[model samples]
Target chain A: MGFIDARELPDGHTVETDVCIVGAGAAGLALASALSSGTGGARVLLVESGGFEHDDHTQYLHQGQVVGREYPLGISRLRYFGGTTNHWGGNVRPLDAIDMEPRPWVPHSGWPITRAELDPYYERALAFLGLPDDAFELEAWTDGKACRPWELEAELAETEIFPAVAPELRQLGAVRRASIEESANVDVLLHANVLEFETDDPPRAVRAVRVATLQDERFRVQARLFVLATGGIENARLLLLSSSVASAGLGNDHDLVGRYFADHLVIPPVGDLWLSDPELPLDLYLERARANATGRAMGRAIFRLPDGVQREQRLQNCGVQLGPTMPLDVAIRRGKAFRSLDYAWRAVQEGDLPDDFHYHVANVIADVDELVAGGYRLASYRAAYPTWHVDLIAVAEPAPNPESRVRLGDERDPLGQRRIVLDWRLSPSDQDSVRRSTDLLAAAFALAGIGRVRVQMPEGGLDWFRPSPHMHHLGTTRMADDPKSGVVDRNCRVHGIENLWIAGSSVFPTYGHVNPTFTILALAFRLGDHLRGVLA
Target chain B: MTTPFAVRRRDVLRLLAALGGAGFGAGAGVGAGAQAEAASRETLVAARVRLRLVSPESASLLGAAYLRDRPDEDSPAHLAVALGLDAGATDIAAIAARHRDDLRSGRVHRLDGFGFSRTELRLCALLYLTDRA
Candidate 1:
């Protein structure tokens, strides 16, 4: 059995390991997988909040795939060994070099290390994640064939196609679980909800992780190194809740633990590209499209702001995807009876593994128009039939807005910790990023042989509207060399705090328009290497 | 979340963010007390309006702009107040009544989720009828 299939934890009555990692989801498991495999005798203690997929919460809370306000039932994020990765679509993109660059307008921007440094780790991440190879790039590589992301992006999309990961991710997760279980030093614990970090110094040390479960019995696992790889919201929640040393919580010197809360600003299509060039390889292109889109037509190509555009503009980082025309109303309806459809054909419009739950309707309409009219039916199945065609979704870049943050709540959780009141505040600059991105899209949509397009900013404008539930929350605990700038320093370590590292997108200084699991898992791979020394 | 006197920039941003997050449903901005005292009351039809974020060039859009129905009458909190929110009472229905103008004009913008309300708007049409009351 693979790493994820084994429901049983490491056989033990409280045994010791060289290192202890909290959170078993994507980041946590990825790190453990890398560490156990790479390091010798690295005693590892992996703590999971929930159990296997069959576990009560996994099936009840996450099986329905509730997120944002969209889910019909109350959606609580799953606490498990694989964490949220189990639910992820696995669209992996390395943190771009420009993403690490300092933008004066973007407050709390800049990663201490460069993208080049993380390149090798990203490769390790890709391999572990079962993602496609990074095309011909020397820095990043994976076993999967040409990833084949559409080519609006000069460097990335042409080479990278994120391997369709819904089923495979879980399957590989099994392998990862067994490899770790068989290891002599590694001890895996199920239902281990790490409640608090009892620290000695203000920002210098972590003595132990106070872990507990619903059963009420709790124990403190004292490890020289304690890593919190929970997730974007949970990581910050834990920090804010652990009000032991500082009321503001651990590593929240500037109250930055849960600030700069961000998500993908999911833009609907203004129009689809009626390609003037018939020479384009359309069928071959569609096959490689990540198993996300459900319908037929050309694949998604990443949008890079023209060099001149990037240089002159206040652009942080942005990308866009070209998808077949699909209406929200129709998709929601089709999704209601999603079970019976020929999902193989539908996967083209959506992604590989068909999920009606979280994914935006990528395949409701296949852009299959009778005539070569620039505009087809507006929304075919749904009633807005006046205008029809595939649409362009311009994903704006994410900037750190101190105003956009998660705050602590007075209410306690089942674990008796303060509930994190997520107060995601976007700065004026973030709104500008959207507008600038819209303008760039307009310019590109006009230039690229695509069809008519419109850029729709939120009604209350960018600041006043909700960023879509695209599941791309990032930049709460940013990493940097300077203490004042970010939460963790280079190598994903919390500045000044020893033996406490963070894995996952929480440490990202900026966010790109891609799912973070692949790259984040990559970072975990790199971090696990650094941690192997501590394990010994 | 709100202020006693004029809205502070921080409170204003927080209020706007909340409204933006909540899709400018009117009642979503009720948590802040200061917004409650300085209520910009309007009718429901008058409150639900279109809006966009304010940037360098677009900030001009913030000031008074008339809606589809009220072409002449301008929005009260004209300069976009974060997405579409007014810090008022927690009860959304009451809050919607108090700040009808905020909704009618683009002073606040609604967050996403099939925002163009047909039914609530029909009720708002009923509200426009009883204007004198």
Candidate 2:
């Protein structure tokens, strides 16, 4: 029964533990819960910067500058007990085998660990995520009764199923707080911001983590082992902040800490799908199917190229999701209004006067009639079968780029820690892959007699489209077999550090097009098992 | 093998690619077999009258690319039979209506990655035959 508030702790207090897990996100929580469960479980200390709920001061620590492209550095993630899972949409799927393999076309690709090595832990991870089973096929959810998936040409495109935990059970911090708090072997520390890692003369091992609170309460947590489960960006930031022993940073002998950053690129409304049959059985693909016999969560179908085709085309993995059909004019009006409003909002958020704000407002006002009509049509579109038109949204994999990185900014946060500067850039091939993949999808849909697709392109044409990062920060502390190529080794241990390990998507070497949460937890559960042996 | 009305195959491939069609097969030039199958003046007039939506030049370009993959469908009448477009037709509106109906009813032909209705493919084939003549 230990849930310590660092703000209330006396100054200069020291707490000793067997294992100190930092940042109580999905990975941290999973590790804490796993390490503290059952007899012979290790005594664990879990530390989180934020408490059970959020406060402004704690959230402000996440503020960072975006130099390469406009990214939501501050808002993309939350700094609460559950971490970003607090607002996660709950889409979960394991990476395809091809995602882990090194492709000749993609630079800095390949994972130190294979999918086969992580397969056993995926089921456990699913259970941890409150999913009953790990059946990912479309028929598994439908039993071939409720609906049938689109029979696209196998050579061109294949159906991929993604299961999602229900919204009610998504937030791990809210759901597992009681169990985690009740664990006798674990002590949870709230509002404890880890400032630096104090290591030996050569920084070969982490002796203790120097922590502070917003209230200026300073404390220390010494442990036999330390795990940084903060996040992709924060993990790298903290490592860079710990400059006491290693001049560059802890485990910075190779200077590979905050490189190879990647995130799935989302291009919304890339095209419109005109179905040949209005009554096509699209329940499994469109509206998500409910829990099946195995009690798996709701599942929906996504489309992507088969692995062989992707390799043959020398393309990165790109997945497409279909949105509900609406009237063409309504879609146009809605898109225009939303795009203008989005631009204005982003400009305002960046502290710049919204350029053409009045013009966009005027355009929106002029589009009011069509927008209202579209909203009404969308509500009644179910009855009007002949007018079905769905928009295609592409979620593409980002190739590992060394230039795309997260670095320590000059500005210091309230906790006196350097804020991060994220230069998240996409390689030219990244956009090319999406364009080629979308074209192939369009052709495949037409040739299969499925439908025609009217692809959306800017003035730059079909070959180009503006892409937004899908808020999935990955590969900042990438894992590899060698120290020069990655910050962490195959076991997620910082290469030069003996007692320090990294967890979560930050260690993902090559992030796949699907959501990263499933793989993140799988790695965490695997790490938990590994640390259990070490602690024993 | 150049004819007065011969359209460059590269132009056709580029157009097909732009139309979201897969231009898979032989490289950039018309095959001698396709160049040899010439259409009569009557066929050209009928094709122009029937497929007014597609110009003779554009239809010839699209049809040449389509036939390059399926050499067996080189003959305009044979291609028409294969596409189920050999039925009696009254006017351009009837052919257009049938094309739309065919697309809706799954009576379609696929070539160079573009999904084509039977009526549309047959009209294009006839236009190609006319261009060769």
Candidate 3:
């Protein structure tokens, strides 16, 4: 494997490779790794806009780094070789079998491939990322015969709330750095930006890619196959911004280059808890949430909420937050109130929320004072990083709102590429979903006889509604069977274009609450395999 | 049986103390005085009431202090708080945006006229004067 830094290359030269892959993020790196050994001696070029994080400007957010002060949540996404894997929460979950199915109730729903089709890739993905086994079915980690969580306290929550995890704090660059060095077929290029694409006459097969450095040096890399793995927002922006021949852009037959843009409207919640070990210790929930937190089967487990549970009975997602804290008095009955960040996290989008959606923390009054003072305060946690103490984000699905989308802003990046103006198109349908979901969860809370919900939606008064980023942006260049329906075909190749392909969460038509890292990796592997087959 | 809604100040303090850990007992004082101060502040409190906004324009002046908790950001709420709009009129979107920062710091504020949803009691902003009625 060879690494090329885009900052170098003072003289413009044309290099030939079997495949020229653009953008060295998770999708590109994963695809490179998948093909590294599979396609023997096949030349694969992996281009990154920035250098490694040690000297990387992105690590410090140098372009527009505003540490401490929360400037308008300009993307926390990294642009270097590894991309966002630098700060991923590492909770790898397979998209549920149902997620791939098109529910009559769910709008614009479908996954061209099923969960079963991606299972093998899921296994290999976990292996490549150096992640622990699913740990979901091991008996020591679970009940004796049935396989369960490893700890005793986890059983309570597990019996009631099942959670899944990917638990590896993986840095994709490190994974690629270690793996690519041993590969004979891949070339990982740092700081190599894909400036433009050159196609052959008539058929329009991509013949070569124009690579450039910020230093004004230029070069070319020719390949049989080309992949635009430049992330969700950038991929679409580049195509729309790249108006050399096509007026509507590269894959704009349906005008879907940057249209159906989406991210989860993160509705964080603050709820009260006074868990006692009368039959089980508060330590059980605490230890689970503290240690495992959905990855190790201890905290924030994943489980299916019985359908028809909510009044609307809509098929939806469920992940809970209630952990170990010192015993205290729950004033739910007294109509007592302690403003927890939890309250505002849920109803953040009902109002005219920001595109990078968020909410305010009123106050978090614990049923027990000790939980607030120490046991529950973010600064007190030892198992997890203390800095993650603030509002617990209870991510909610921002149902497909065709209106909430990304458009080309009047601004441009350094490359003269159009600046993306994101308008988080939301509607009453989203709020309706939240209200109904809240009602359903409250009913469940009532049934469990735990604590009643004291929800205070934004409509209550003159409370400011600040929206936060869900970090799960998807669906600008969706894949569908028809050219008119989506920009790409099932394999993620641009419908009209011969050699252009896309990678990332962008291809997803519908956004799910579960993190997309695991699924994203699987898709990348599939794409890599397709590329190899083409070369063969 | 449902747990009785009995709130003990020590229980509150103990909760904070546990979170503070062996290092900072100062965080342990779940100060009842502080709670009482918050409860009785001159701010028009809407304990579990709907907090709606009429528009994005008024989000800063009335509901700025009560929007999202920034604690350290240079957002409108931080600006409004600095400008003395702790408990004034605000919009639902403004409150929600401000709340984005509040989640990180657990800050609170109150404005006039606010309302909450009928089903789950979530906040919804119509106008500040509506907070009382």
DockQ of 2: 0.06
Candidate 3: tens digits of C-alpha lDDT, residues B1-133: 1001122223222322232211111222223433344343222222111112122112212232343322343233343343223354323344433333332122323233221111111121212112322
In candidate 2, the residue pairs with backbone N, CA or C atoms under 3 Å apart (3 or more residues apart, or in different chains) clash, namely none
lDDT per residue for candidate 3 within A440-517, as digits (tens), equals 443333223232344434543213333355677678888787888777888989887888888888887776666777
The number of the candidate with the highest TM-score is 2
Q: TM per model?
A: 0.64, 0.76, 0.64
Which stretches in model 3 have alpha-carbon errors above 4 Å?
A: A54-73, A138-169, A200-204, A270-299, A302-312, A315-318, A323-393, A458-467, B1-133
| lDDT accuracy of residue B43 in candidate 3 | 25
The window of 10 residues in a row where model 2 chain B has the poorest summed lDDT is B19-28
What is each candidate's DockQ, to 2 decimals? 0.02, 0.06, 0.02
* CA error at residue B84 for candidate 2, angstroms: 19
Q: Candidate 1 lDDT, tens digit per residue, A76-167? A: 35555566555655455665677777766566666777778888887776566554454324223222344322234242113233234445
Where does model 1 sit among the CAPRI classes? incorrect
